[model samples]
Target: MQYKPASWLAAIPLAAMMGVCVGQAGPSQVGPDPTLPKPQRGLLPDMVIAKPAPWGDKTPTVPDGYTITAIATDLKIPRQTLILPNGDILVAEGKGGNAPNLKPKDVIAGIIKARGTSSVKGGDRLTLLRDTDGDGNYEVLTFAENLNAPYGLALVDNNLYVANQDAVVRFDYQPGQSKASGPPETVTPLPSDINHHWTKAMTASADGQYLYVGIGSNSNITERGMTAEVDRARVWRINARTGEHKSYATGLRNPTALTIQPGTDQLWAVVNERDEIGPNLVPDYLTSVQEGAFYGWPYSYWGKNVDERVRPQDPAKVATAIKPDYSLGSHVAALGVDFSNEAMGAQFADGAFVGEHGSWNRKDPVGYKVVFVPFRDGKPFGAPVDFVAGFRDKDGTTRGRPVGVTVDPKGALIVADDLSNTIWRVTPTQAAKSQQPVAAAQ
Candidate 1:
């Protein structure tokens, strides 16, 4: 037990016996056409969670001409962030999921996974940060409290929407207010029967006429039975004026983070794909979501590649499943995505930054850092580039795990590092040196 978890120890030989390809280890499994290695199941997948460590005086590394700053610290498990009209930042701080373990393997897996995370309890609140004078120094404030595991935030006109674990709530807004005037009213309720994947990523339509919610599947691969999966594994289209919602698309396993592509109404997501088949079988993806589309889930993956794990599988459904637009590599565990602009400097100005929370299912871990997936003509065209690194080291010690990435209007990237309980802001080196004060809100 001191050297390795029993399940992981048992899984080593199985992987070798199956001859799972190790060539897809690093970057080869990235981009549009990643090599899909044959799936291999074990008694349990490799459990390689990084032991949590302190950042101390160290910060995440960025490319040349850029700087990384800790804008806020000592947070309560911050998950997502939103930038207000007046330059204020609201951080959603919480984690919510209570799916009962279906087997001993799940219970063991949970214990192994907890080691790489922060020990803080979920804040269930929103923390606000403002640069009143536009000087880079931000004063932290509490914007809202007593929330039910809120994970998503959106602003359309004067209404601010918060997507909590069980519902989407709304509050009237007036830009500079540091706190909510009152309690939020529920815009619509979300399915919460068994939240194996509880994070509800959300965004507003360009015209503010509708809201899109990413509801994840109840279990990893429908182990909870297909009955528990109703209204799960798909994005929901909700009327902004009312609480009505309908399934926008299906077959996505866990659409963890969602956003509207800048300048278009197209919805895009960074999904966390299924696990335990093999280290490199299913590549997690970043894809443009269609109105009525299905990207393979339990029955198949990456277009008609059938997964025999699913029982009573629907062949027709598998036939209809479409491949994702871009692959972010298998088991990256991507949790956040945001489109970048020139404010982040010229090299990274035109793409989406994704927060890969890192992996726990492989011998050689992938994704414990933030990556930039380049785009061309509004579509992701190339392999992902690591924008921020040094989260996990060679010894498997992690000081941070990035969850949500936000592109600030002023040309900086706001990153949420849940393991460190910190919020990091990345910007151009010149901007960091300047620290120019912003005009105070009137």
Candidate 2:
């Protein structure tokens, strides 16, 4: 597949092609250091296919030994995610827009009746999990309400950290504790101005010493109208204990999901590109982040290629910026990302899974399901393969949309569906290990 360069005169393979060497880090060392807490033993809610989902044109299927079950369903606009130690999933539900329950045409009428907003308060937040069968299902859990517009979540020891619209907060969380009761503690006040709801996306480093937070640009590449500091689209590293912060990397438009690759300790981010260019022009991307490297945003894109649409107030610095590693098509709106460090059934022995939230800018929307980007030697392989599909209908209508994705303790792929308000689990087949090509497995 050929990617269109911003300038016709530009050459392809923007960077020197590195040899694709492959290796695997031991599973035991997949995540953070030993000081970090172990995986939670909380029982996850029993996720069963309640009824036939209106699977559109594509039928959703998993490996033979695995099944896709719902952890919880009927949720409001679920945004980012954090899976608790007790098997429960904490979700940041963004306020409503034109969604599955309502027709797109009727969305406008409903918005007006909502008094410009749903009765669901902007601060309303909830927890979804189950404690089924005294085991891995987090079925028996309480729903907590009244949280600021939270987007990112992390678990440190016994505490749950939440990134609200303006700050990063915490709460005491016990496996069986009821969510309706515990009081949240304010951990750190994030940089939040009213002009831009700096949707904070966060994740703790493998060692747990640092917490990385993503603060998106205030406007669509406008950089909050600041002429001096154009480095607003960036990820910050904060002392998990002290809250002292410093910029980790800059020049990202809206990096939604952040993760550190297992074993390699490499940082990766999935970003939403600037919009209003032709639907298929500006591409949404996923890339391995290098410290101190600047990814061109308002001033440029795909690495230092200036977008004529937005006149770069500072043209001198545009030529030296860095570009992305993988292009997820134009307008696919790639969001949540997870590395398959655990043996997830078998097909994904060494790779990362990403959730493309689907596209709206294009005439024909794509990316409603989860896709796998296989990696070797700490980089993306051939291309992204379809992992779990079936969100859209035959008539181009959607009944479900994927948002956040994670790998459960059982090694199953868990995906968060915002439109249907559910968590879908994809279990692997027993043959996963043996199914890998002999040489590839080695």
Best by TM-score: 1
Query: Cα lDDT of model 2 overall?
Result: 0.63
- Model 1 TM-score relative to the real fold: 0.92
Candidate with the greatest lDDT versus the true structure: 1
The worst-scoring run of ten residues by lDDT in candidate 1 lies at 433-442
Off by over 4 Å in 1: 1-27, 430-442
TM-score of each prediction? 0.92, 0.76
Off by over 4 Å in 2: 1-59, 63-65, 96-123, 134-140, 194-198, 227-231, 437-442
lDDT of 1 by residue, 1-442 (tens): 2334565546546444232334236447887788887788776776676889899999999987788899899999999999998989999999899987777677667877888889999999999999889778999999999998999888999999999999999999997999999999999999988789999999999999999999999988888889999999999999987989999999999998999998999999989899888788689999999989999898899989998999988999998999899899889899999998767766676789999999887777899999988887787866677889999999888999999999998888999999999999988866433432111110
Cα RMSD for candidates in order: 5.7, 13.4
What TM-score would candidate 2 get against the native?
0.76
Query: On a 0 to 100 scale, what is the lDDT of residue 306 in model 1?
Result: 92
Shift of residue 305 alpha carbon in model 1, Å: 0.6
Alpha-carbon error at 174 in model 2, in Å? Answer: 3.7
